[model samples]
Target chain A: WLHHPASVHQDGITVEGLIRRSLEAKEFAYCPYSRFRVGAALLAHDGKVFTGCNVENACYNLGMCAERNTICKAVSEGYRSFKAVAIASDLIDQFISPCGGCRQFMREFGTSWDVYLSKPDGSYVEMNISELLPVSFGPEDLSMKKVLKIPNKY
Target chain B: WLHHPASVHQDGITVEGLIRRSLEAKEFAYCPYSRFRVGAALLAHDGKVFTGCNVENACYNLGMCAERNTICKAVSEGYRSFKAVAIASDLIDQFISPCGGCRQFMREFGTSWDVYLSKPDGSYVEMNISELLPVSFGPEDLSMKKVLKIPNKY
Candidate 1:
């Protein structure tokens, strides 16, 4: 089973406020080569928040996605479970979903979590992780029996 | 600059052989997961050789390290700007590297390609799509002045 919770802001964190924060975080993007900017925020299970932005490098394959970056931030702080995630991008107005790699990493935390996408106007859409990763694999799929066993023994 | 090359095998390939094939691909793991598994190999990177393995996840803040899986097999396809990729698991000898995450996604392809992984006996591996992903997020990062300007308007 999975857990999902709603997302909202306190102390008057209006739509404009959220978008601005995303934009501010955008400045932190490390796209040395590719100038695309992406920012993300995660609402942790314990009520704390984590923020991140895209980081790029000269080697195209060495870059990290914004979604992954946010999750890594939360993990680095010792937060394993999540309640919601919010993402904003300079590329599109219509909300976009996390990349496939991001979705897989999200599953590792908990298959049932909420995700929010922000628009330039501050309006947003909400989704569940399961909706994004339907019929997916988890640690259970690699059961202990399956993982622990070897081919043969003497 | 990082040497991007190809990998190869001189055998008639058996299941056992495939596992070793995949194991060799694990060397260049970008795994932030700390669960290290190296899958490197000798190939013909335009007549050169290279290797790779699984890279783990990062919070949406930092990122999972990059270019671990597909690079190994990339050299084999003769494309060389990373033509393909092979994968191996970081688990105890019996596991396979290519997961649904690697197949349904994990961008490393020019055209169709081959994959390999290890088995329980250090004797075999598996093979599948070397060019697993088709559409990946490859965008040029436009600068802030370009980004802030509203698009398609006077």
Candidate 2:
């Protein structure tokens, strides 16, 4: 069923080369801690492809996943809007999804953006960022004006 | 004086190229959301330099700091131990230090590791990881055997 990439209507966006790039990106993962390699590729509105691999750290929490890394790289390069993203992991039996932290990160961009989850062999599933992280918080939540109005307990 | 790098004794680790790299890395920060740019450089045991810029996401928490990014890149490339880390930010009046998350992340490598906080013009202050993040939690605290024994509330 994964054959027809053009037919997979994810908010009217097609999955053309993201899956391949995601798979290719896996080779760059630095995951000695978990031994779980993950790769991600993002397609920007300008048709630019940004790819990232999981970079693990001795401190587990400090590690960054492939999806977040890709988004970070894309943003650093000045691309704000994204069309689609594809993620691939080595887990063949089950499709792995973006973690809570990454989902929250993705929500900062666009909730309607397409997300593809894939296994080693390229077989995959698709979902939108909204479905992955429903009712998420964003820049709107960090209201400095509201915070300053709180009475000092001390 | 800032000119004499050797005088900046950060727990006995001398300030070398870290300051320059940190400043240069700042150019790549993706911080459209916060507009707070940060850059970091890590010196590995082998004397290799890994640099990173703060990569922000739409979900603020999903953002990766320059310090963590440097560590991730270093670790992913197969370097486990680190010698010193340098951080640079745009905050000119005060030297910007690593946040709590980055501090906890740095503690994973070594408590005594040198940490340098710098401004745009290369003026900096130095501290060790332990001093920055005291009474920190780490992998050791996650003793699964002990946690498993705790009775389930449900």
Candidate 3:
């Protein structure tokens, strides 16, 4: 398993533990449709861990990925800031990275958050959120000053 | 609120109740970034109700939409088929429809699933999943028989 050193590790758990959590989460995935199971584990700034597995719907558009669900659980529990997230998928041969939607979603939380993409073997490559979603649209773009205000002084 | 005559109305709840659930779900949205709150409610085949609101992440791509999250909750609870879904957003002037990704996600469950798009005032319009996402990709396309087998008998 190849490991890129994680820049911001949270909690006392080793990276292997985080990867294992993601792998464990995959068991709960409800992916009868695509049969592509994915799991994710989020490390909150407060040292709490949140994990989720992909849940597919009969309607393809209603499917929720493990990464997003993990974040949702974290947010619902009132954890906003995050240190890192590890994602695992059994699709071998290639690293399973977060989808574009997930990359953008994580951008809404922290630009420097570490993202670990892992294979079934627990080996992972690390990339920061900024690297995953460069030049992203964010909270600043939705500010009233930028969205509702005129460009120059009247 | 304008109500569409639902072809498959499960439970005795009026269509307005479903739309209201969608609107109510929007209250719990964790959308500090976009400020565009959206809510969704799903009516399971068993007449159970599941609700969700947009949960945004620092990584914008990792955000979960109300529609998808509601479906995920239902599926996680062991419900497979759905009767209908209602979505509400504060964005006025036009009715808020599911995003392309959501349309595709919902398509995974049932093509004929009723999708109601509503405004805060409760005014809404209705369309089926097939209409929202025509010529869609689905499970049949990913079947192992079609994926791994040769086209004719050897």
Find the candidate with the highest TM-score and give its number: 2
Residues B1-154 of candidate 2: C-alpha lDDT, one tens digit per residue:
1334456433333464678878888888878789999988888887787788898765566678888877766654556689889899899888888998888878777788888888787777778888897887765665445635657878
- Measured against the true structure, the TM-scores of the candidates, in listed sequence, are 0.53, 0.71, 0.63
**lDDT string, candidate 1, A17-100, tens digits:** 444566567668877665566788777776676778988777876798788898998899899988777777765535544665
What stretches of model 1 exceed 4 Å from their correct place?
A1-20, A141-143, A151-154, B1-76, B79-154
Q: Is the docking of candidate 2 incorrect, acceptable, medium or high quality?
A: acceptable
Predictions: Cα RMSD each: 9.4, 5.5, 6.7
Better candidate number, 2 or 3, judged by DockQ: 2
- Which CAPRI tier for candidate 3? acceptable
* Candidate 2 Cα outliers beyond 4 Å, as residue runs: A1-37, A44-50, A53-63, A77-81, A130-154, B1-16, B32-34, B46-48, B57-59, B76-79, B134-136, B140-148, B151-154
TM-score values for chain B across all models: 0.44, 0.85, 0.88
Model 3 native-contact share: 0.34
Looking at model 1, give its docking quality level: incorrect
Q: Distance from true position, residue B3, model 3, in Å?
A: 2.0
Tell me which of candidates 2 and 3 scores higher on lDDT.
3
DockQ of 2: 0.30
- Regions more than 4 Å wrong, model 3: A1-20, A28-35, A45-50, A54-65, A72-79, A91-101, A116-154, B1-17, B28-34, B46-48, B55-65, B72-79, B91-95, B122-127, B130-138, B141-154
